[model samples]
Target: MSELKLNAIDFISFAVAGNTFKLKANLIGPNDQFHSVNLDIAPDEIKNKTIGEIEKLALQALRSA
Candidate 1:
């Protein structure tokens, strides 16, 4: 066999609560165990607000930036 060796790897795993989750980022899972995960970005909660309110939110971000 060649002398090359595996020195590092990238992995991910996660656990969840009622509506929240704890993601173990950059984690190396056990060799015999299988872990699967999916990523999602929750939609913003601003949909029900008025357009003026949304405009206000935009300005707020510009001010912060």
Candidate 2:
């Protein structure tokens, strides 16, 4: 399969009760189309993570989808 590329990330919302943040991941598909994925993540999940690391995660999610 062709590699998926991470395009951008947008903040959707935060659930204070659950302590989770919602994010919209924008990716470039293998066919050059844009794909959007919504991810719910805890703040700790991204703490101290570099941009490259986060990009890798996004790409992995795209591939799985």
What tens digits encode model 1's per-residue C-alpha lDDT throughout 1-65?
Answer: 11222222233223334332222212123453332222221234423545444334333433354
Q: Give the alpha carbon lDDT tens digit for every residue of 1-65 in model 2.
A: 24666778887688899898787877776668887777777888856767667667676676688
TM-score of candidate 1 against the unseen true structure? 0.31
- lDDT score, candidate 2, position 63: 67
The numbered model that scores best in TM-score is: 2
Error of 1 at 58 (Å): 0.6
Off by over 4 Å in 2: none
Alpha carbon lDDT of each predicted model: 0.31, 0.73
Q: Which stretches of model 1 miss by more than 4 angstroms?
A: 1-44
lDDT of 2 at 29: 63
Q: How far is candidate 2 from the true structure (C-alpha RMSD, Å)?
A: 2.3
Deviation in Å, model 1, residue 11 alpha carbon: 32
